[model samples]
Target: MPDNVLENVGEEYEFEFVDVQSTPVVINSLGSDSADVGLLAYSSLANAIQNEMIPGGQSVIAPLTYDGPRYADTYNSTSGSSITDINGLDGNTLGVNGVGSAIDIAARVVLTRNDIDLDNVEFREVSFGAMPSTLSEGRVDVGTFIQPFFEMNSDDLQTVFDTTDAFGSFLKIFVTARDDFIDENDDAIRAFLGDLWTGIEWWKDDDNSETRLDIAEEVVELPRDLLEALVQTDRGYYHGEDGLAIDPEWLQKPIDGMAEVGFLDEEIDMSEYVDNSYLPEEANTEPTIE
Candidate 1:
């Protein structure tokens, strides 16, 4: 998508894409002025706010995606485990990418929604790459796993619940910038949003699926079949249909949920962490795409 956008807007602007593995690191990098813009899960944004990494006036400005249930499943090893569902997770150890990560917030929300007590469940820090091994070794009874790990270890795991089942469709991630950056580079930021929105629209079009898969294969070096399967399963990708504009009201679910699960001290004003003035008024109406 970046390549496609650059092909059209290269003369106007250029962006460097860096892969910061986790949300905490992403927020830290943003706080230290390492990057002008960063994408983080909505809950992670809340975490950053509570941690004071994002000050009073700085905030995210655009929506990156709305996630579905294709990935991010709670699983238990198939070895005589009694944890068949969220309710059965009591007294079980759940492995997560981090203690206060997006998955942790989701798990807590899901468990609480079902009246499942969280005190009995232990959340262990396990890396994404190490999840399959952790589950396979019986180190953790329940683990929150996302693709392609979920897909790879389905045979050895039992499905407990999916994130969507806990919380319905919600705003997933957003593009954020510090207050000073947003103030000093308004025009550049708008242009970047315009270009990014156009790229998102291009990628969402069914006609470009093959081209997108080809690009994904080349960039990530994953097997073409896996890439094909991702697009087919409605894997959690960015939503370009919304012109990338953010909705503060929708974000309250994750933020409130985070507090409900004790990840945050209390519910925060979602508006403080979001500014949608730079986005197009209408979804899919980016001028660059036109």
Candidate 2:
């Protein structure tokens, strides 16, 4: 957590972190005022806004990460599978984390771009942790993996393609708050964004890479060696720029792609939903390092 590294921020504000794995639950929690701020994939948040799940819609405060060359959501098959490439996936079993999740949408976009008929392929919803084993055991011909899971099991799995091929460097996850919540607690939101930027800057520095992995190990159940491997290969998280600012141009790719694949009811103008006012001044400036 950011508070772990930024003790002074924690001293100023009190925070209670809740682990809600399901995206729908996160949306509902925000709607009911059960959660102040929520983390959501681009698809989930866009769907919630279109459907009016949250009272006054959501205000996207900051972007968490984007799918890019260094790191991205992946499509994988067994090390020695018959399906060697994206074109060969026709009529084969495809596994996704969820049917309508962000990864699922990305898979559809990739398949569509390859001219693979969506109806001809079978999609099985599997957990990320189980995807590797599921492919290894022949339960599914191909599975989708994100982050450490793909890096951890790379030796046993072969990549078919990543989301970058279809969506380019698109927005993946972001931080959001209910419209009413932002209106009600302006100061708190700014403080949180400021603290979050501080944490992001600290995490981006090369000097603190080992410490970042250590913090990751403490929070997640993965081993230190595995975490080290992920960091060493640059397969870890990619928080864009210093202040964690939202880039409308990068976000538009997914918005257009989701509509093209019918994942979203209609394309949305992200400018209306994104609120950069809450972010600190540093968010607008370029990073000192890269």
Candidate 3:
């Protein structure tokens, strides 16, 4: 999305994409002023603030994606495995990219709801790329998958459950910056958000579907047909009528869930951390596309 935004409004502002491995690193970068803006899972915000990872802490400025019934992270086992559902996960190993990551927290919430003791369920930190193989090899009874990984390997996996089953439709990933940086670059941030909303609007239009898939094909390393399937399903991204507006209620679900599962020290009020003021007025208006 940032790349698309740059293409449409490059003359107005400059952006450099830095590849970071995880949300913690993104938070560290923002806290140190090394990065003006970073993408992070909504579940990590409270912990970052509580740990004092950022000097003045971070503020979420825009939502990047949402996860729910149609699209969400999933816990899966090999297609013919004995672990047919969440009930089969008891006293078994679960794989996640990180122990306290958004994926892990979501899984914890689901397990807790099923009356499964977290102490009995082992959480193995398996990278996303390794999850499919890990499950197939019996190294982990279930592994969490996101995006193209899930779509790419669906034929061999059976989903035990989806995160949405626990938290409902919730804000997944979001854009954040240090509170001080937001204060310093108010107008520039607003302009950037406006352009970002423009990019989002362009992408959400059904007319641009082919072009969007063509662009994804270049970067995603997936078959053309698979890419088309993702595009057909809105690529599992949230494109609401409010454009780039961040709904505090959408974010609060995960925040409260994270705390319930002990991923966060306590629930952080999302309204306090979300600053929709940076979004332009047009963002609140309904999208022009159907």
Alpha-carbon TM-score of each model against the true structure = 0.86, 0.92, 0.92
User: Considering only N, C-alpha and C atoms within 3 Å, which residue pairs clash in candidate 1?
Assistant: none
Backbone clash pairs for candidate 2 read none
For each candidate, the alpha-carbon lDDT, in order, equals: 0.72, 0.80, 0.81
Q: Tally clashes: model 2.
A: 0
Error of 3 at 222 (Å): 2.3
Which regions of candidate 1 are displaced past 4 Å?
1-4, 7-9, 69-81, 238-243, 281-290
lDDT of 2 at 149: 88
Write model 3 residue lDDT over 1-290, tens digit each, in one string: 55543443465566788788988888878878889899988756767876888897778888776786357889999999899889898989999999888888888898899999999999999999988888888999999999888988999999999888788888788889888887887777887887777877777678988888888888876798988878648556555535666768778888898889876766678888888788878885422221
Residue 135 error, candidate 1, Å: 1.0
- Which segments of candidate 3 are over 4 A away from where they belong? 1-8, 232-235, 285-290
Candidate order by TM-score, highest to lowest?
Answer: 2, 3, 1
Reference-based lDDT, residue 117, model 1? 82
Per-candidate alpha-carbon RMSD to the true structure: 3.8, 2.3, 2.7
lDDT of 1 at 289: 15
